[model samples]
Target: MTATPVDTRPLAIDARGLVKRFDKTLAVDGVDIAIPEGAIYGILGPNGAGKTTTLRMLLGIIDPDAGTRSVLGASNPQDVARRIGYLPEERGLYPAMKCDEAIGFMGALRGLPLKVGKERGRELLEAHGLGHAIDKQIRQLSKGMAQTVQLLGTLVHRPKLVVFDEPFSGLDAINQGKLEVLIRGLADEGTTVIFSTHVIAHAERLCEGIAIIAGGKVPFTGPVDEARDRIPAQVRLETRSADGPWRAALPGDTRRVGNYWSFPLPETGVEPLLKALIDGDAGILSLSIERAGLHDAFVAIAGEAAARDMVTRGGGEAA
Candidate 1:
């Protein structure tokens, strides 16, 4: 006999046309997202790309000028805030406070009793490998240990939704692994996790879906596999494998780099190119088709968006 797996798809976080403006500057310009329950959804962008601003707006730290965002079915930020555990990018912990004190304070802020907060604090410190440093002051702990304390504090209230902003920053490889495990455990326990970071590689392993924002707008928002599928899997054939007419016969965005050639492939239909290469018979040495990685996709999409922004601004300047 086997137990049935629970269905975990629900709208944990939903936003439509979210816009946040500060004076004349639009920090977040009309973003929309639907994040499923128990899923890790990553928001990725470069510096000053409005990732932090979007998160703040969603957490009710700052109100959006236009559009609506809901966390856990409550369109009102204040109402949903109590059910959310948030770790902001700019971390703050009182240097004089002990690890237990800090964690208890965070839990108390989330409406837990002092005794319960203290007990949970001890458990988290141990779980995160900070048990030895539990009584130590925040100032005395190492940066990685302090980070662990902060992460534990966020989870104290058992919130259904957790928002982590650059959660892996300032941690060693070991600590990063620890954090990844903890995050996965949270999602497994039925918590929806959303995080924003500039590091795309971290998100590649940590998130099932990702929303890539650039210049205050989302360019890609879907499952990681789906996003990867949108880009062509390219193969490089670096050989002196043709006569002068070979350039024209090559298929789909082929470029000659040094003595080698790079070709961006269209999905399917590689038979024509394969036949041409064999027919040309000009000494083919090595041919390899590399599946387009997330970095390649990010650079392609983000670069295009940036170029468009530049052209738009250039036109305005000329006018």
Candidate 2:
């Protein structure tokens, strides 16, 4: 018997120039995203930004009009489908089916036997605090519970890569936190987790790297820190008086925001400005700063049109 060697490359997904269209509308345009093994990557964009379309093409559910993609080191995504688990943006489950049965069915479809699926389903449900609902029908579960079960089904097969589309949608704050913990744990165990969301906060908190998609294209793809760097740091300071000699020392675009006066931190440094403010006999009530978050980064990376798109859409989805 001959021994076959395993390929130990760190890339879990390599895709470039992936384009897709529907009718006259181009859903995805020249988007390129590369995900490393065991990474928690987020595809972030607003509604109708072609996020779902991109994921579909990457998973091989739909063929791209142009470009190439490889999943799990294979040119054909279907060949590695069993190694990938997916939870779609839309809810999918047999309403009449029992919770355990539903999960087992999903597992079975990925090549696990019925009996093994059922056994694993029961164990997963129990381990995840859903043991009481072992015999509960899908229709009887709460919307959040149903969503969680579907997520579990996506994992029942123990896939190497898990793809979730809007997984945080419709979940309560507590459940959302739980889902984040779960996803983080999965990556710790060596499973690559990729999820798409319009919520910059979710991506900011959970992802190591992100792709900011807008207007059917990805404008930024890199580590979260790099993305945050796209936006300038904001300096927020509070003082005993709003107007004084400090005004002359203040940076050009200062504005009052709630309790603090804020302005874009100069690239030169904050220490010089701090010295100027202090030299002017400015009474510094409290000196603090607000770093640019992913929301700020999203606006900077996505640009004006996408910024309007994000803000008009509430800057985040319900999740």
Candidate 3:
């Protein structure tokens, strides 16, 4: 029987030992990220966690101090820039320029001829419900309309790789939904899409894999389910009798959150503890194993990094 080969070439977006320093301050420190092709990857981080810096480095807008990075197999930014589309967190649009003109300009920058760019711009605008805004100046459009225009411009060239930095920031619920659908459609069509967001719920909904970055570093990187699985399942106990000894019977790591007693599953088994709670006259109002939530995991990792940075800064200040 022939053995199947493990395909482990460098990922679609791979950064190895990436470091960025400005004077004495290090923004991104020895970060390594690997994003697969045709995947919706998210970089989940709070503001100023080097997420933007990382994205900038990936797109070759800025160079790293020490590392190798590539996008779509192109090691040089100039060579790869044509194949990648980026929507930066800071929305940049020529306010006085008409919507059609703005998008066409961006498309032209990506090497599309004027006629083709104009036609493509119209198609995208009309398809995205901006048909009437073709002649309207960006200054005359609402924030949502402007945002849609920017997004349409980013995709007008059909770049194989799209990087969105906080793309959903100012979008309301309705527009956010529209953007989500558009992003999903892009990924479904084989675009290697990656976006950065501080919103965990949005990441959970849109990303197949994610890298949770905090304090200028990535603490978690993998598939969403794999990340969740790395966190032990919590056994939740809700009892009518709050005064029961069942709390003490559980492991030391077990915690009381509100009325629920959460005990992490033991390496060996939880059956013994389950039986103990039953035998102890605990009402057992609810007994269930709760999988780790993405928010919970993000908090756990990000909080640790933040606390460590605080302690380090405190020591430096005292010295």
Candidate 4:
């Protein structure tokens, strides 16, 4: 049988050899990304890994020292700025502005008329469960509520592409869950969502494709499952007998700790091993296969040091 062809969707954001420098420091080096339209993509990395720099260059927030990019089919990102929405890592809103007004202001910035922005802002507020705060001042809301308002503003214009940088930062567990739902909802509506996050769990849960960046360079990029497949699936077996002829069937690398024997699943498949176990009078108590998680894949692909840095930062903004 032929293997399934990889995703051939049209590109929403195509960037190649993007390089950026801040004074003497090389912030991003030769980054290339092709995000398929309507797919949820993630830029995963540790702090100061040049994720923000790469994003800024893609959005035309900053010019790359080298390389090229196309945003929403336009060679110049600014030409299509109205069709894209961005939420930077640093969140800010005028404290004196009412919630609806703040959201409207954001929409207006994206070319929506002030009146229409206000109307849509109110509707967005209601839709996101922030209607009660529509008339309230930004200063009066809690941090999570304020962040939600800013996020609502980002969506009020209904842009085709949305980019969020460390969006999960500063959010509590419940708010984080809500944000995940909101992101999936955006994708369900055919919006292309690209988010930069050091949190691997978020990328694993939401991203169809990801670019793993470390030290201002991309170490790996592609489907989430492909990354996970870099590490082998592990097998856990429990048997009534610790030693028997069936033990010989276990892979040489198998380890015994207490009552469990763990090892990488055999290439020949489990059927042969099960047969040997049964024939050798080894009473199997239980067995399970555990697929490798994104965390393990991250460590293998991005290196242990980069993975440690990611864990150390844990959702904080990149330097």
Best by lDDT: 4
Candidate number of the best TM-score: 4
Instruction: Go through the candidates in order and give each one's C-alpha lDDT.
Output: 0.80, 0.88, 0.82, 0.91
In candidate 1, what are the lDDT values of residues 103-217, reduced to their tens digit? 9999888888878988899998887778898899999988888888888999898999999988877789988888888889999999999998767778888888888888888
Q: Write the per-residue lDDT of candidate 3 for residues 1-319, one digit (tens) a residue.
A: 2464554644788889889997888888888888988889999777777888888899999899999987888887668787888898878899998888899898888887767877888999999898999999999999989999999999999999999998888889999999899889998898989998767788889998898777777888888876777778878878888867766678898788999988787765777777877888878888898889887677676786553442243110100
Clash list (residue pairs), candidate 3: none
Q: Write candidate 2's Cα lDDT for 207-252 as tens digits.
A: 9889998888888998898888777788889887767787887788
Task: Please state every model's RMSD to the true fold in angstroms.
Answer: 6.5, 6.5, 5.6, 1.6
Comparing 1 and 2 by TM-score, which wins? 2
Q: What lDDT would candidate 4 get against the real structure?
A: 0.91
In model 1, where do residues sit more than 4 Å from their true spots?
A: 1-8, 237-252, 255-261, 271-287, 304-319
**Which runs in model 2 stand beyond 4 Å of their true positions?**
1-9, 240-249, 256-260, 303-319
When summed lDDT is taken over every stretch of 10 residues in candidate 4, the lowest stretch is 310-319
lDDT of 1 at 314: 18
lDDT of residue 307 for candidate 3: 36
Error of 4 at 150 (Å): 0.7
Compute each candidate's TM-score over C-alphas.
0.82, 0.87, 0.84, 0.96
Tell me the deviation in Å of residue 293 in model 1.
1.9
